[model samples]
Target: MTNAPLILVVEDDVQISRVLQTSLEGAGYRVAWAATLGAAIGEARSRQPDLVLLDLGLPDGDGLSLIPQLREFSVAPIVVLSARGREEDKIRALDLGADDFVAKPFSIGEVQARIRAGLRRQRQATYAEPIFRFGNLRVDLEGRSLRRNDEEIHLTPTEFKLLLTLIEHRGKAMTQRFLLNAVWGPQSLDQAQYLRVYMAQLRRKIEADPARPRYLKTETGVGYRFVPED
Candidate 1:
């Protein structure tokens, strides 16, 4: 069996599907594509891809319909790639079971990064012990504790949740909307300022110097990324 992670790209547009396949393969990931929803379901079952990049607009039916069905059989992470940009649409997809969402006309670099993050999170979830260590920072998943050099680091409930979300998907650029939805809730998706405020608090508590953050790096117009130490 091939060791490279397999990604199923469910897109109807031929050219777009080609681009996605080429890009993913170029990044050393094995890819399978299906233009229709039925084909996608079949491919997914047979191949058991490591991740799925789904497009909401499918010729046979709504791609959203496949999310729950896919979930019935596989625990692989699903990242929606579609033209549906409205907040409700995104929330609906997330609620349905998608791990992440990227609207159409997205940067290839960003999508690739998100895919890597999703795969990493999926693997970590299956681990017997999901303890993460980065430099002086350590996160204990089962105990829900944070420590710096063996000393417990105090984090407010909100701050702790935000930090956990980032660390769980470390190495991926999480959009502001995604972060808000995950940390706050669907109603708080519009509250960008809340994220900024909490992120500042997190940085102050965790960083050696908040001015020069090492782990919680911002993605400028996008969102934030948790860069774990090598």
Candidate 2:
């Protein structure tokens, strides 16, 4: 039998974590729990979970700080589970690479839906077209290599995924929410800042002039589009 998808639940609150574990397992996911940022990071590295449910207010430190470390080794989608409901808090988490954000008092059904959406996006990206090219920029999706002007351009996994998502929908204006959901997962749909930050980074690497980008065009208030040629 295939092993159920593994979900790491990182929350310091015992009751909340327990409830999450029960709910996730009931939905056919295998669950792992961590009560602190340190344990969450360590377990995430060791266990290599398929998804992470992270709580920002950990006992040891802020969970937002763990995102870069987690990104380094795993492309697993991270869904933030926090009591902090401010828009700024949500933006911060998504910008740092959290796939989705679930505030306190969330319904188990909503969380489950997010999890399913995240997993589906991950699977699609993983099995997407293996190669894409525009001008001198060449992307070998299966090989995970990118080159511009025949010179190698190294990209973080997150950046690479963003680029690929844009390429997949070339010539179409992808809204901020659609791009965020496609690349960072559904929980990040509202985090336009994340898209801005990464798009700038991508432009710097691929465009001859970052300020006057030819391929990556901004739709202003909508989102972005990728043009194969000028």
Question: What is residue 87's positional error in candidate 1, in angstroms?
Answer: 2.0
Number of the top TM-score candidate: 1
Q: TM-score of predicted model 2?
A: 0.60
lDDT (10s digit) by residue, model 1, range 147-225: 9986999888888899888877766557788899999999998889999999999999888989889988986666777
TM-score of each candidate? Answer: 0.72, 0.60
* Worst 10-residue lDDT window, candidate 2: 166-175
Clashing pairs in 2: 100-187
Residue 82 lDDT (model 2): 82
What lDDT would each prediction earn against the true structure? Answer: 0.86, 0.82
